[model samples]
Target: MRRLAYIRALLLVGLLLAQSRPAAAQTNLIRNPGFEAPYSAWGGIGPIQVAHEWTPWWSEQPDHNPPWYRPEWKPAEAQFFPNRVLSGERAQQWFTFHASHYAGMYQQVFNVVPGVRYQFSVYAQVWSSVEDDPYPSVLPANPRLQIGIDPTGNWNAFSGDIVWSGEAPMNAVIDQWGYMVVEATAQNNVITVFMKTSPDFANKHNDTYWDNANLIVAGQAPPPTNTPAPPTPIPSDTPVPPPTAVPSDTPVPPPTAVPSDTPVPPPTNTPAPATATLPPTATLPPTNTPIPPTETPEPTATEPPPTETPAPTNTATATATVEVILETIEPTEGPTALPAATEVVAADSGGSGAVAEPGEATGNPPAAVEEADSTAASSTILVVLVGGLALVLTVVVLLLVWRRITGAG
Candidate 1:
């Protein structure tokens, strides 16, 4: 009973392990993260909109606030946006590490779930132009770029700013850039990313760049640890089963060594019978020899029978008629030799005594077969011309031999 229980427990553990699912890879939730398009998809502050998907934010306060204020956050084209851009051209440009720039931009992100941890990241840089701000000697105030999430699109319901930095500030140096990443669990479904720069009244040419903003859902936690199984206690009063009661089927004894060795001698002797079996197959060679003789006689047998058939008799009669006509024409047309050969070819093609084809009488025969027959007739005429030239040469040699014998006499 204890063994049966242990077997059942082991099966249950294997079943659970088979049914468990593996964790999936993390996916990004933010759309149009590079801000390479027009600002039609993003909500922007009225006059200070610099780049697409990017809105500038300031620290100014107004009582009649439509939030119509601009802060130090502005757009600056990186090295890749094609234009005769001024020292501070505010347009989306390609970054060395990213596809395009956001340049101080933030937009509302979708599909954020509550209590799920997410990672947000962006590459940001700062640029200063000699034409815009000439005062390099005076150290400028560092710029601030902030990312935040808000449940509501309004500024009042702002969740705490995303903690993308620990002790290091989110400030970018002039012509230097780095990635800023933040990890936090969302409290709501909608995430509104924010980008803000610190107000610098003294520095007019300060430009900040942001690009490749992304939001990725972090990996989920594994299932809770399984509870430990209870320890099995040993029985004290149970009587032990007899060893004789164990199954006799399990312990199969190996065959006796004498029997195994005896079988080896039999196998050596058994090869004689195996070799004896080959003679019956060797006798099959006599059977195969009779087949080739029968097969070789087949071609000679079939060829003579075909020549005796009525089709060959018809063809032979046609060729004999063509030969007599050629001999009669050869006496009159000695020089016009090829033309007589052509006529012979036409006669052999059954020109005068030709039986009408099955389709020709009812106009049902295919035109294609008629064209093929015409091509075959032309090829046969060509072969006859070559034979006629050889006949002419043979006649010329016979006449020369006759003349030489007469002159020798």
Candidate 2:
């Protein structure tokens, strides 16, 4: 009877142990979570193959293509590495060789209870370098590693319904492992888990390794660990101080008045000396010099009154001779008879008597008449010159006046 009791007790304890175990250990919805299976070329995409239960995905946008698309260009490569495994004999690795890619893998998990919460986690590490330097002394190895769960069971990696976790810390030490976790409530009976990374640089050794992914039922949520502590309370017996009074409005001092004892000098009002208005400067008109009139010699009986000289038949020659006579005549205060008067008459008579007539005519009435005639001619020429000068002066004055009017306008 005691042996029977002992057996029953052992069975009861074993059932309790099974029931108390963590949900993660009891059920993991992920398949091939450790990546123990060999990666095969199943998908048509080249240069990288996926492990079992994972579908390879990448951004199809042209901008997301590899930086260099050479025939030998491989944006990413994935394979199973036995030496780098965290637990099992083999682990999965995805890397680039002087190239970068925005790609990852996903798996759809089904048979989940609707409205139940689920947690997805994965252990990942990165070894990003440049020029064979493990840490890339200059450039940062910003391989942003993260994991996500799409509660809607969507295959699209960029679906908005996906809940992503914070980036897994980059392992400064190679092969060092870190885990990223994200939780989501099941919207339906199916969910999708994703493992993704985007290395900022296309270095020579931008490598990442992932293993031990998990998705398990999350039971009752744990209490928040970061709840703020209640503020300290004042003691009941402590005395309270009244707040000091503050004026609602400050008073402004009035401006000081000038002292009556201080005298200010009065402004001098002496009128400016009246500007002397000198009469406008007198401007006298140009004076016209009076020319003495030629005296007419009275005709005496000894010489009958000289006959009026006939007009020369060749008027042009006569006029030219008269002009020559005027040019040769010297300036004098009064009209003086020119000796060349007979030559002038001779030239007007076609120059035939230019020399003979002056000698033939002695101190006779004809000579005196000729002298008188010469004087008359000089007077007429003087009058004409004075009139011409006046005309020129009038034209100059008009031009100056016109210029002044235009300038003022």
Candidate 3:
């Protein structure tokens, strides 16, 4: 009977042990879940950096090194003062010194049953500081912790179909571990699980540590809800009234008068004339006319013989005659042949003599000899003025012609 009792006890113990063991279907689908693998074992095929079965990922949007093996991925071994490992001899850790990062790691699991729901979870912690000084009080913003599952097994970290967990709650204690979990329905035979942390600020030490990533099959997903469309509103029988029109003659308030200390001038009673008026007989103030000094006749200057008169040429004949008259002027009382030089009878014209008697030359009275002299001087002055004006007019015409030719070119 004692042997029978021992057999029964053995059976009972076996049953208890069997019940305590986890089912084979519930085994972890991740490799190196605790990141206990040696650094030499960590490698990748191409651009990717693999930590055993997990691959590092980072947003290229921020300036960062390619998602390759970096010093930050070195395993965190336990130290004397503060321990980083949560379960085994080593844990996965990444940090930025005097910088910030949005980075994480993901593992893809295959052979998942489509339409089955699964849960992804991880334990994460952060230590954000300013210039190596821990926060005196609570941390201003703890590094955001999240775990996600992509049912479609997409490699993209920001895929729209990813199911993400709420931000893991942080505690006042520095380097305190927090739990994060997310669930999703598998749409294919493969799915991916991720562990991520985004530092709020580029602190001196923005560090994050992760360990014990886990994936497990949840129960079948719930049925999708079918919400009915909202009913459209029925039209009302009453018509909306048109806006009232403003009356054209509506009285507008007058502009406010601004007060000023300066006095305004009164309007003048006299009307402004249409055109400026002048005096009935406008008399200009008399201007002084300078009298020319009389030229004394040179007694020694002899009149040239009539034959000395140059024959009229096409060019400068009038000019030569005027010059001769100016040079050979003698006193009218003297029997000088001055009149011969003054009269320029063209050689080509049918004229008998170039000289003439003084009375017949200018048809002036002998008593008015000084007056004749004055008249001759006036005529010479007038001729010089006219010649100067003609020269100016010719120069202006030549300049205008030159400008037009250049403009056309």
Residue 267, candidate 2: alpha-carbon lDDT? 14
Q: How do the residues 139-252 of candidate 1 rate in per-residue lDDT, one tens digit apiece?
A: 333444444444333332123333323211423334544455555667677666654443222232345556556667645432222212212211111112211222132222
Candidate 1, clashing residue pairs?
54-105, 58-71, 359-365
Q: Per-candidate RMSD vs. true structure?
A: 40.1, 31.2, 29.4
Regions more than 4 Å wrong, model 3: 1-25, 40-50, 62-71, 79-82, 131-140, 172-174, 219-409
* Tens digits of per-residue lDDT for model 3, 326-357: 44542233334234333433222335644445
Q: After superposition, how far is residue 375 of candidate 1 from its true place, in Å?
A: 99
Runs in model 1 with CA error above 4 Å?
1-25, 40-47, 50-56, 61-105, 128-138, 151-172, 219-409
Model 2 per-residue lDDT tens digits across residues 1-409: 9999999999999999999986543567788887766667433434455677777654322233223111111212223444345666556677655555455678999999899888876667676654465443334356777677888898776666777766555543244566566788889899999877666545555577776777887654322222222122111111122112221212111121111112211111111122222222222222222222223323332132221221222233434554555555534433234345555554555544436443465334376456667677777778557655655665565566555544543
TM-scores, all candidates, are 0.35, 0.48, 0.44
Sort the predicted structures by lDDT, highest score first. 2, 3, 1
The residue-level lDDT of candidate 2 at 214 comes to 73
Model 1 compared with the native: what TM-score? 0.35
